[model samples]
Target chain A: MSGPDPERFDAFDARLKKAREQRQEAPERGAVDRSGMGTGLQAGIDVVAGVIGGLLIGWALDRWLGTSPVLLVVFLFLGAAAGTRNAFRTLQRLMEEGDRR
Target chain B: MASPLDQFIIKPIIPIEIAGADLSFTNSALWMAISVAAIYTLVMLGTRQAALVPGRLQSVVELSYEFVASMIRDNAGREGMKYFPIIFSLFMFILFGNMLGMIPGSFTFTSHIIVTFFMAACVFVTVTVIGFMKHGLHFLTLFTPPGAPKAIWPLLVPVEILSYCVRPISLSVRLFCNMLAGLTMMKVFATFAVALGIFGFAPLLIIIALTGLKILVAFLQAYIFTVLTCVYLHDSLHLH
Candidate 1:
């Protein structure tokens, strides 16, 4: 049995191509609206993750060194700082992408 | 009625023990294998006939190829295509895994923190190794932000290191939480539907709506994971 007709196949291909192009253009216009909430959530997670990671590492170091509260206190501040910086960076990147678009 | 969380139970089909290790093949493993097999069949068989005028499956395959190709090009540049296979495989695996999990009674490996963390860790390690290999000790300069004063280097370095160290954690948590939330919501609604008996119409409508949302979330999470991987690749390769 013969495959699909050549002309019919070409017409279908053209329609698919058009649809794909439309999708491609749609994202550019919708990027901010689409990712607004997602970006905010990601930034929040980045900050939280940074702080928790730092706290864990610092607490472990304090336990190992027998320094008790000193290292923990220091690391807590450091972790907070790190978390803030990460949040800043994330927002910066989002802004840059928005500007680029 | 069965507990909603019972869907996630990893019951072993063929219990096996090797050298005192519990290496039994569980439901999660079975679903993972199913995902891989499905992807293989879709791509391999779908594109077997490379016709100028393609069929539906061939169009899907081609569109995915172009989608990922443009992603890499736009994010990581031409040099990044060397890692295309890894990125493409990652995207397809997660995409298929997420899509498959939407089916009732199937396991979602991506919903597990351990699995997502493992994949994130792999990406983190690979990117770090690539950075070190390409730039030698200069890669250490990644910790130092440009235009920062030398006096503040000591303060900035630790913060940068801390942020960098938490990448895998954040990446894994993002995917895990999203998937778990979607699955849990569906389960809760399903429970409501059954419990509501004759007045189950409202819960049924909500469940239907949620299924559509879950499908969108699956695609979005997969896309996000792949895009982040590309971003990491770009950062490591260019030191930006």
Candidate 2:
């Protein structure tokens, strides 16, 4: 046979994309609950962890560099900012997942 | 009355010293061994028959397989299926640990930050290695969002790195905190039930409800952990 028609291949590609999207959009069975309690707990953990992680890293760096309180204060603010970013990203991901379901 | 936190005390069953390290077999280790054995037995019994018409054990095994498989497929796409063994093992281990700990007087190893942190760190290291392997130096670009302003790259990159580095902490802390809080609350309420005597039924009722909720949390936390692993794996494989 000669080369397959280009238009036909395009049509098939579109159909395939549509099918995949549909399969993804269908709500999965036995899905874990992501709303209410789960979301709240997850966001809280992300924020708290971000802050704690930043603080520890900052404290250790300060001790090693003999910078005393300077790096500690800067990292403390950075840690809070990171924590907020983490919480925002987590919520955004959950919201996108919620939309899909 | 005993303190509610007394249940978490790790007493050595067999003390062994190797060099400077204290490598003692403790209650926590015992419970972990038990959880592993239980999981192995369930899988062995479930698959021993390998029948066309499934028995109860086989059904449970098959259901768990399907659940994890679908979760991977959904979150990570087709390429992610290659890491099924690690993800499945994690799911079963945590699920088994949580469920077994529900039994009175049993230790909950997952409640310990060290254990959960170790697991999460392993995941973080594995995913990072895979990302670097797959994309080489380009993996560093993961810090930068697509189509972002170049001027803000310095500020944004550190924040991105901070968030990235915090994954293991958040992952471990989430499971640790949940197990710790739930088990502590249960113990405290049980203490209340005993102290109240006849009115023990009030706290008893609360404990009953909390038990059900705890079971749900056990499963949900396991699922959440596995799902997040898949998401991270997907990120490594396919960047943003």
Candidate 3:
């Protein structure tokens, strides 16, 4: 078969380029971007869970060892520290993810 | 008006007690079974044709597969592909569970801490086991943070270990609380919409917005849960 007309081929190529540009410029509607609220909620929960986990461990150890409130007090602080660390790490990861996006 | 929390109450459908153990199939269990059945049907429908050019159902299946596959590659690296089956199953299960729960009267099993905790705990155990298996005794070195002064080892080590232990708790609580809070808030707003009568339009509008938000939250929570699991897997697979 004879080659297609040059003018029509050029027009089609330009149209295809424009469509590709538009697709690249616009965000993908199907893939929802991570929201600030979701990230914030996650960070907050991470901190809280860290604290809770530490407290539980401390409380259990204290009860088992019959140390009364001494170990409990120490663990409460350690748990808070751990929780803060986790929250800090979460925020850091969020920043890294944002950079990647 | 029924209490907003009433939606969470588990009532036994088929109560079976054996030797003082309560083996009851409740509404929660029923919904879980329904979710599983719905997922199975969708996957079966999507894959049965196996067309070269995918139809609508096949497109959905392919899209989800690509989504989780990319998510795994991005978060967990190439080696993590081995665990794709478990990760994909977890994602689909939670996604379906959350979406189904959005139905007006469906049970949200994910809202329960026990269910989420069990899943999270399993992931934690698996990841830990994999780390130990791969690295042997070297896995213990994971607790020692990189570039820390040797002097503060005592303080930092405990903190690091505690934070590591915090993974499962954080994972489970994040999902459970989101579902619990979203559902409760919607139920409360729904009650207001009913009680307001002539001025019900206010809460009615809020409920509409909240409904949309809850749907987004449901999907987001599932995505985050899977992503975090991948992250944890990545950490175990490659230290630091």
In order of appearance, the predictions have TM-scores of 0.88, 0.91, 0.93
Q: What would the per-residue lDDT of candidate 1 be over residues B1-240, giving only the tens digit for each residue?
A: 777778777799889999999999988889889989998998997789998998999999998888888888877888889999999999999999899999987899899999899999999999999999999999989999999999999888988888888888888888988999999999999889888998988999999999998998899888888888898888889997
Whole-model alpha-carbon lDDT for candidate 1 = 0.86
Could you tell me how far off, in angstroms, the CA of residue B143 lies in candidate 2 after the best superposition? 0.4
What range of 10 consecutive residues in model 3 chain B has the weakest lDDT sum? Answer: B34-43
Ranked candidates, highest TM-score first = 3, 2, 1
- What digit string (tens of lDDT, one per residue) describes model 3 on residues B1-240? 799999999999999999999989999999999988987898899999999999999999999999999989988999999999999999999999899999998899999999999999999999999899989989989999999999999999999999999899999999999999999999998899899898999999999999999999899889989999999999999988
- State the lDDT of candidate 2 residue by residue for A1-101, as single tens digits: 58999999999999999999999888774566655977887888888888898899889999999998888887777777787788897898888887776
What's each prediction's clash count?
0, 0, 0
The number of the candidate with the highest lDDT is 3
Give the Cα RMSD of candidate 1. Answer: 6.2
Off by over 4 Å in 1: A1-35
Compute the lDDT of residue B20 as modeled in candidate 1.
Answer: 100
**Pairs with backbone N, CA or C atoms under 3 Å apart (clashes), candidate 1:** none
Worst 10 residues of 1 chain B by lDDT: B1-10
TM-score of 3: 0.93
Worst 10 residues of 2 chain B by lDDT: B154-163
